[model samples]
Target: MPNWGEWAALAGGVPVTEERDPARDAARIEQLDPAYHHHDPSVPERIWDWIGEQLDKALGSVGVPASGISTVLLFVLVLVVLAGLLWWRLGAPRRAAGRAVALFGSGGPAGADEHRAAAAGHAAAGRWTEAVREQLRALIRGLEERTLLDVRPGRTADEAAAEAGRVLPEHAEALRRAARTFDDVVYGEHTADAGAYQALLDLDRAVTASRPTLAGSTS
Candidate 1:
């Protein structure tokens, strides 16, 4: 068979080093086929050429190993997964968490038109809870897209309000009050009527117009 150092170097686009260990590559060849050891020199050359082709293809699909692009890609994937997990564990705001939830949907959470249709469905069915839930969800989604507030259901209202306040201290009290109202209607024992719904709609609009800061606020 071919010299392991030459083959590995050809595959890796590196020079064969005299001090390099060849036993590992040799063992790999042995696993492929123990009979390969008996092959002629031409056979080993062809095999190395094939390995070179494969490495070339792998490199093209990604990039040169110089940038550690493959390693960085793996690291990025791991970081994305970890970030998603952290958002989940920390009870990211409804808006923030929806990003993860959207992954479960066929084409992601329904678009605005779809949401409107769903809201209409809830309204037609007279399912106040469902209608309110849908509206609240839409509001949260809009806020997130606009970078107004990073709301998530897993996060408490106080936490969300605090975040909103930090992002827009000028509207902090208003945000806090709105959050309190939302909590009361959505989770409290009180029944939310048309007036409450209107109030929520108003709050959503106000928050949208606030031109709030980014989620990462110093306060």
Candidate 2:
């Protein structure tokens, strides 16, 4: 696997807390299949070599040994955090961006495109309630990403429509209707249908193509 440390090191180094241990790297490599740990300079070997070099450099910067298990663990945690931030930047769960606790009791996608994909998957599987919910999530996230609406954490579907309505008044009624559909499937425990999902999907496409009116301006 690539170390990914080179890119991570661009963030700069901190004080190292551990010393290099020769046996450590060998032990880790040993844990993997010997078929993959060979000395051949084949493509895979080259890739592994590059990863090793990058890791060594990053470890050197922070005075942490490449074999420093504790430092490696810390790097894993930092990587996870960076991943979460990237997810947020891409319009995923804004720490519950889709809304109330029940809105995401089973978790959700990590971005607008992802939500749309999930919605499609559900629709294909004949899961209309799930499809409607995910489609609406895509709409909300897409709006937020385009700056049509502020990225408000914990905002409900209705709040999202109401707020977005101020800027896209032409779509106000449609947005409200869409929000109600979302609330019905998500909170009202109502079942949805292909028609409902299609309606939300159509609205999502329309809103994506429609330009939001500038603040204090008329369309």
Candidate 3:
């Protein structure tokens, strides 16, 4: 009968005789560097390479020379960058205008007294648009003071007209027309005249004499 080692050898099993050498194994691993086996590029390099390949293919299809394609791409990139910057800058004024409309509707005056004074001053200067805007503000403020209309923050002229109209049904049409006039001057960029200013002034006076209706009653 064969010995265990001989039997194992005959069965094609090798005996574990050699001990693992940590330092030598590490050195061997370093010599056979795994990094060299990994042929894939880094993320940014891969992205740039992919973009270049796609660009080359596209330009080639259009019969554009590879040399000129780079210049065209650079020009397109510059245009994209400039467009982004322009949008960022010009967006501010529109946003500010929207914020102003939300905060004070057309524009803000200090108070009803200040608005009335400013309206008078504008009227004297023949700035009818400014006069009309200030007068409307004065009218809205007066209604707010009398508790005829609840104090609404960020109220537009149209909204004020509707609320005030519900309370003063007699002047509803006039109020709506006056509000439209104010909106036309402020937002529509239309010019105002003496007739428009006088109409707003008349509406302002009428609002002052108006009384609040019963709670939850349009009548």
**What's the residue-level lDDT of 136 in candidate 2?**
89
Better of 2 and 3 by TM-score: 2
TM-scores for every predicted model: 0.38, 0.51, 0.50
Cα RMSD (angstroms) for every candidate in the order listed? 20.0, 23.6, 16.6
Q: Give the alpha-carbon lDDT of every model.
A: 0.59, 0.79, 0.79
Residue-level lDDT of model 3, residues 1-219, one tens digit each, is 877877787688765364799999998888688676587688999899999999999999999999998899899999999998876544445434344353145456757777888898999999988898888888888888788888887887878889999888888899988877777677545689998888888878877876656668755
How would you order the candidates by TM-score, starting with the best? 2, 3, 1
Per-residue accuracy of model 2 over 42-94 as CA lDDT, tens digit each: 89878978877787787779887657845686789899999987764443443
lDDT of 1 by residue, 83-174 (tens): 98876544436444333232112343444335545655776777655555455555556656665554344555556657767766776776
Candidate 1, RMSD to the unseen true structure: 20.0
Q: In model 3, which regions exceed 4 Å deviation?
A: 1-108, 216-219
| Candidate 2 lDDT trough over 10 residues, lowest sum | 97-106
lDDT of 1: 0.59
Taking all chains together, the TM-score of candidate 2 against the true structure is 0.51
Clash tally for model 2 = 0
Q: Residue 18 in candidate 2 has what lDDT?
A: 51
